[model samples]
Target chain A: MTTLMAWRNLRQDPIRFAATVIGIVFAVVLISLQTGMLLGFMKTSAGLVENAGADVWIMARGTSNVDQSGLLNESAYYRALTVDGVESVARVVIQFSGWKRPDGGMESVILVGFDPRTGMAAPWNIVEGSRDALLAPNAVMVDRLYADKLGVSKLGDRVEIVERMAVIAGFTSGVRTFTQSPYVFTSYNNALRYTNVEHGGASYMLVKAKPGVEPAALAERLGAVLTKEEVLTTSDFASRTRQYWILTTGAGSALIMGAALGGLVGVIIVAQTLYSATVERLAEYATLTAIGAGTGYLNRIVLTQSLIAGGIGFTVAAVIASVLAASSASSPAAVLLPPLAIATIGILTLALCAIASLLAIRKLYTIDPTSVFR
Target chain B: MIQTPESLIVEDAVLTYGKGEFATPALRGVSLTAKPGEVLLIRGPSGSGKTTLLQLMGAMKEPDKGKVSICGTPTTGLSQKRLRAMRLNRIGFVFQFFNLLSSLRAWENIAAPLDIIGMDRGAAEKRAKALLAEFGLADRADHFPKQLSGGQRQRLAVARAIAHDPPVILADEPTAALDTENGQAVAQILRDLAVKEGRIVVLVSHDHRLEPMVDREITIEDGRVVEERGPARPKSNALRSTLSALIEARRAASGDGRGGSGARQEGPRISSLS
Candidate 1:
């Protein structure tokens, strides 16, 4: 009955009702878009650790980012392999090197070297060539998304890494880096030729746990033996990397603030819309009172109206946001509207609508049944 | 097939609005009794507290002093919620403005009080349809109140009030905005409701022609009853019809008819002593 009355009241003025619905839709879209962008920002900040197949990473002491590690003694890799739960450990090196393109442009690139035997912490999402292509002489792999930025035209293009020339062996898709520097993937022997790491020293070790073994246990065991380096499980590494860029550097706070502002705007729009709608029908409400409707009944009708408007607005906004999210799949700035994100937006929208109805309900509580006699 | 109303009683009720130096008394110790199957009329000049008294009887307002009761249940000091429930289950109202909910269709408007009583919606709607047909508004069931004529809207208001089968019907100038024909038609319906259904019908009006239809007439002035008529069926149906025509003729001759609009002009109208 409340819904029936609410719907009828809404339908009384089609233009006003439509305007209210549009206002709500505008607010909802703003929130979803801002939140989606924030999620995209956070996901990109931790991309390296999330995409790594290794269960644990042993980085140089005080290494905050996977792409910015200091040199570590290569002997840590052998010590990690002796751990009871350790299956295989891959020797890895990462170093910032200047790349001189044939077009006479220079760009910084992170030269990533991983042992092909352990097959851990390597470039993924390959679109143009096999991972084995990196084994060729002077071979290296880069993401297609960064091809223009890295000054590469095609496979077989020659570029100088740290004054040493290398051939573009493959192109990977969607391997976007958050550090602005592009990743150059190659074999450990090839990487050593391009970086200044000391002989018999690697930047990091990627440790894989054995089947049925937990990565946390493996990390603890390696942590006890390798006192000079820090051992972190995959999830911990990802969290640390995200916190470093997002929280400490304030890279993601701007997006969070934007989402919050969108929410506030949505609340104002919805509250104003519902409030005006309630005002427009104050006489009708007074009539309801005269006809014996209690205050509770009046409140139910208003909340039901708000929910209806919000439900429609959220549906339209979610569909629009999802389509936008899917369309950004190939872009470096991905829009991630995951299931959890969608659910959160749903709860937030409904709660805002409930809050917005408060103003209208306050007006209803002031209605005097005797006013009809006047 | 006899029906009876829960008799209504108001004893020395007093009410005042505002505070301190601004206080103005609205109703002053007005007492009245309306028995089952009686059509009682309250006539008074503007601001005579007739409307305020009617509001008290409907449980819309609590008097600052004195007591109002329906079927011996005193309404003083009752919670607002309880007062509203009593109104929903026992009292019906007809307003001068025909305050029908404009958004709802005629049937929905009529079914509103029934819905408040927690009736099955389907059954409530069926009863509303039947009442609409009885009011000659069957074809207007799906039309919103704004889409109806003034007379039709007033009829809809009356139908809505009585839809829940309340024992008491209180109307304030129900026919003030209608033509003489509509006014007479509405009065006839209220008269039939009281006589045939044995419900208590009380109305406050300034128009004198409605007198023929009521069983008793109480004229009030300055918040007090100046005069009271007998509880007598003084006029026959034919006489009531004739009296309605005479009043319409008198208004037409006096130029108060307002170009055949049939609505009585606002303000005090002098009634013939006959």
Candidate 2:
């Protein structure tokens, strides 16, 4: 019965009801967009660790994150292989190198050099060409999102990395970087040549646990033997990388704050609209109160109205977020609206409206039922 | 059939608004009671606390230094929840402005009190329809409050007040918004509700025109009862019918006899007098 009354009350003033719904929709869209962008960027920050097929990562001692590792002697690779439960250790070279675009424009790129035979720490999603293509001399790969930005188009196209000639051997899909650089995949030997580094010098080593062996146990074993380097399980490495960008560089904090501000604006708008609606109908409410309607009955009416607004607003915002995500698929700034993100936004919208309804409820509590006589 | 109303009692009620230097007394040491099968009318100018006394009797507020009871239950110290329950199940109200929920149609508005009592929707609807028909508003049952004439809206408010068959009916100037003829017709209905149906009707108004129709009249001045008059002869239904017919004739002469637009200007006439 209270629900029916709420429905009727909202219909009484269609324009005002619509204004309230629009306020809710605005909140939903802003929060979803800001949060979606943050998730997309966070994914990029942990791209390499998440995609790497290795069970553990070995980096230089005192390395705070995946992107800030020092070069280790090639001996760390063989030393990791000697640990019990260690299957095959692959040496990887991750370095920042200058790249000359096809038009001679200079851009910084992360040269990820891996063993083409093992494919460890290599691009997991290849949109063009195959892994074997990296076996070719001076062969390298670039993410499709940055292919146009880096001035590379086809697999056979040649570009300059570190002032050394390199061919675009493959195109990786969705391999974006938080550091504002495109990852260029190449063979270990080619990477050494391009970066002009000495042989047997690697920035990191990818370690795979033997079948049926626990990666954590193997990581601990390698940690004991390799005192000069740090060994981390894949999960820990991903977390460390994400936290680095989110906490240290101020990027993560800024994105979270943006999302919070969007939510705050949405709350304020919904609160004001709902409060005004309540004020407009104060007399009617007072009449009800005089006739013996309890607080619970009145609460049901206001909350039902709020939930209706939330349900419609969520649908509108989700549709807009999905469209934005689809269009950004090929752009460096990806918009990610996953199922979890959609669900979170839906719940948040409901909560926001509920909180906004509290303001109206306060006014309800103070109403003198006798005022209806006036 | 209307159940008999339990006697409502107010004992030396004293009520004041504001505090200390800003204090303004609304009611002062007033006392009254209305038994079953009686129509009690309270008359006073604005600020004389006639309305305040009505509120106190209705359990809408508590007196500062007195006691009020309905059906033998003390209401001054009752919890809000309990007071609300007592009101919902026992009392009905008709406000001066005809405070019908604008969002609801006439039938829905009448069904509101029943709905609050958790009555089944179908039964409540049927009862509302019956009540609307009894008030000669059968055709306007589906109309919203704004779509009805001032008189029709007042009638609808009365219908809503009695929808749940509450034993005690509190009407604060139920006819204040209507013309004299419609006002008399409404007053006739209140008399019928009290004498014929055996329910207690307490009306608060400044309109002395209501004097002859009621069993008792209590006049208040400066928050105190100045005079009390009571036990008038109950007017016959034929006289009530004559007053109603006069309204209908005026309604018809003005236009469609529908009262939707024509009844506003048709104030009280000689035909309305018993």
Task: Chain A TM-score per model, please list them.
Answer: 0.95, 0.97
Give per-residue CA lDDT, model 2, range A290-336, as digits (tens): 98888777888888877777788788878987888888888888779
Work out the iRMS of candidate 2: 1.1
lDDT of 2 by residue, B1-274 (tens): 2221256788899999999999999988998888655789988888999888988888888899888877566788888888888788667898888999988889999998888878899999998897877787888889999998887888888888877666578999888778888888888878776665545689998777888888888889999999988667555787546534544543454342212122222222112121
Instruction: Please report, as a residue range, the 10-residue window in candidate 2 chain A with the lowest summed lDDT.
Output: A115-124
Question: TM-score for all predictions?
Answer: 0.91, 0.91
lDDT of 1 by residue, A211-309 (tens): 999889889989999988899999998888888877777767877787778778877877888899898888889888888899899999999998888
Per residue, candidate 1 scores C-alpha lDDT tens digits across B47-145 of 899989998999988889998987556788899989998888778899888988877889999988988889899998998898887788878899988
DockQ of each: 0.58, 0.59
User: Residue B67 in candidate 2 has what lDDT?
Assistant: 88
Give the range of the ten consecutive residues with the poorest summed lDDT in model 1 chain A.
A195-204
Q: Native contacts retained per candidate? A: 0.79, 0.81
Clashing pairs in 2: B180-B268, B181-B268
